[model samples]
Target chain A: MTNMALYKREMKGSIKLLVIFSAVITLYVSIIIGMYDPELMKTLDGFVEAMPELMASVGMKADAATLLGFMVSYLYGFILLIFPMLFCILRGNALIAKYVDKGSMALLTAAPVKRRTIAFTQMKVLVSGILLLILYSTILEFICAESGFPGELDITSLIMLNGGLLCLHLFIGSICFLSSCLFSDTKYSIGFGAGIPILMYVLQMLANVGGDAETAKYFTFFTLFHPDGIIAGESQAAVSSLILLAGAIILYALGIIIFDRKDLHL
Target chain B: MSIIKVERLVRDYGGGKGVFDVSFHVDQGEAFGFLGPNGAGKTTTIRHLMGFLKPASGECSINGLDCWRERDKVQANLGYIPGEISFFEDLSGTEFLKFIAEYRKIGIQNRREELLERFELDPRNKIKKMSKGMKQKLGIVAAFMHDPDILILDEPTSGLDPLMQNRFIDLIAEEKKHGKTILMSSHMFEEVERTCDRIGIIRKGRMVAVDAAASLRERHTRSYTVTLESESAAEAFAIDFNGMRKGLKVTVTTKQSLEEIFMNYYGGEKHDEHGAV
Candidate 1:
């Protein structure tokens, strides 16, 4: 189908917000990292041990017991997941729910486009916006690393970590898309969109802290893309990330199908 | 051929309210008006015809194609202006129009300039900055820009000034001349009387009447007020009028037109009391 028009329109409308958000996040992370002097082993040790708990809360891993590991864990665990999720929530809320809420869906549904085409185009815009944010964060990470912090910057591992994070974000985006299709109210869509990830994050944290419920970790995309898991060279996490990414694609497909068949009243 | 047909269409909003078993047809090149007061299911009927809402029972078809089953094809042949025209506030009017044009895959081809001049709209202004009437004008222009075979307008002139309303009527007339079918839903009786070839009056989720405007007026029971020179004369006239009545009912009273009563009680200079006296 000729769905590029909607995709282009959505992309143009959302890219500016994504850029501004990424810039703000990068600046904030840079300042936090700048305050650390990684040469102090005692201070570094304290930071590392504390970092794992923080990462765990943010749906990251607690296995990173070193400065670099802590930094990667924090970045991957909290910043990466939280930022893109916020992006997804905002974009997803606006995509379907906002149109329905504002009665603009009447106009769109009356046009020559199919409902599937509309959903797919919205997904394309969301995925593209998220990918751009990932790209910006990766570039910013490298720039921060080169700013002469006293730690060994493992560029390859960081790249892999961010790549995994991107996959997780894509999964979150799909979740948001599905939720958006399910809800007609934009506020409710956003609530569920952001809430689902946080719920998963909490579940993962509980699985970690509760010890016996580690199996629950497998249910979350965050668990699959944990930074410490990747740093420890655990192939399981990488495999799981791939599986979750596949799940994301399936969710997005389902969202489009549901949108197509369901009645859209405006 | 009928460009639009709705048969036993039932749409419920889950709260026990919506259009129920509504059936109507709009022939090719006809200006059809769906008229009702507020909460009369007019918008609901239009929404089903546009394929935005699926009927709970029965069907809606546009140009002989099922609206729900053959949506894309049906929609391609129609232009629609919704009741509420909210746009992406961040985009300029030019950008919004360009986006729609691209989607429709039709070049503006001087249509933009013509419509802009006709509506006095500035293409450069962001949608958020424009007034409600300006936005409505933009929607009207966008709906017509592609020059589709049918135009479905819901409350098209709600926010327009009298001048713009006249321009809108003229635009519809032009479309009619070009043989474009129109299905318009509105609450304004005068507009329906002025432009529609046929009208369907919906009340309480059912079509109460559908006929030519003149026929509707003729069918409606009208009230007549008759004033006599005196109360006794009024009583006598009332008895005579009742005996002579064909359809209209006449009420005889000492009541006078406010203007005439005012002229009698508060006499002023003829020029000052009434214009061009």
Candidate 2:
């Protein structure tokens, strides 16, 4: 179903970007975990009360009774979402659309390999990239929390939170991959691939602001991930994660089929 | 049986912009030249043979297998050099070749090494930093390294210097001698005249002519412009030679080279327009 040589080539080509993103995200996770002080939370609550709308709009809250809640409110709201989304958008576009747009796809297609195999290999590269990024942050979070405030974080809730985060990113990466496959031009691929996810993140933020803006969540895929609910180990979070995983599978499959059937102008 | 075949292949891109009712075949161990000017659907037709495209109507097959349905099987014994050569820019030339070898599961590196030396391509430099001619040489090496039975090359010598072009033409001639079936699309008449057994000239998505290379040259009548001292003398000379007279010039047709015949096919309508005026 996939070509291992192509998989290795793609993985090698994208490894630098993955490493850079992983390092940056893990750094952010460590810093956030390190800053999980109850005294600082009390002070932050004072500012949160002063600027409730502004803080809420960014998915930030100082109302945390545990280390995991503090981490979720600070990191999952923006840093975690934006960084990995950037990786997905850029890496996804580079995986397929970049080669086609630059006319290098002819080299691959000229080989005996099927188009389906090439697409499948690229998908594996992308999916693995997202997994590694999420996994790196998850491990770093554990290491940081255990060393800094041992036993302060709930093991089950933290696992559930990271699981939901993984599913959400996989879904976002698939959206980028589909758009990448749909357009033969990088500008258009990046435009829609990067555009849609960033839009969803903004909507998620606006929905978090509460009141009339709450309906905006319905329009965004990001709403499927409720960091607070996942941290509380809600069944709804698990179902939403499953839905995200399902959507990712469908989008990836559609991308592969479309690439196999489309006419390549290369 | 034909080693490669296209039966009434039609891919309409609309507004008369695509190949229409295009048909041709290459027998085993024959070199067929596909000649066309820019935007003449040369690459479009070749794309179908490579199975990168499905024809709107009709079909293309290689070794009796449908090109589109069994592309992988077809490509297994086929090599292709696309009109535009682009590569993985980040990889060094050596790395790209190794990658292709691994991708194709080629165990023997002898042919690849020989081609690299013949082309004088230093695979040490990153492809992004290499010159266009170097990249072209790399494309040629990668396409031929597998030593496939069928080779489809589009403008294979486009960016090469005259020396390298001659080398490529010689290479094609040698490959033809080895009984490789080659379908080469080119704009250069000299290379085709030197290497191809037959030539097919395509213009405006239609095959204007397909004939033996030697016959296309032999059958074409060359046009010459004879200058006289006066318009009367030119008119007198034109009548004697049964040529057209314009001022002090008398145009006569004699023997044409392959280049002129190709020009006639490509610019035939424009030439007729000028004659009408």
lDDT of model 2, residue A193: 97
Candidate 1 docking DockQ:
0.63
Model 1 agreement with the true structure over A1-266: per-residue lDDT tens digits: 53778877788779778877887778767864554454443454565477745434554444445545757645655666677888988898888888888877775677889988888888888889889998888787777766755455777777777778778889999999998887888878878887988788777776655456777777765667766777677898688778779988998999888888877656
* CAPRI level of candidate 2: medium
TM-score of each: 0.83, 0.91
Cα RMSD (angstroms) for every candidate in the order listed: 9.4, 6.1
Candidate 2 per-residue lDDT over residues B94-156, each given as its tens digit = 999999999988877788888888888899999999998999999999999999999999989
Best by lDDT: 2
Worst 10 residues of 2 chain A by lDDT: A56-65
Q: Which ten residues in a row have the lowest lDDT in candidate 2 chain B?
A: B268-277
True contacts kept of 2: 0.87
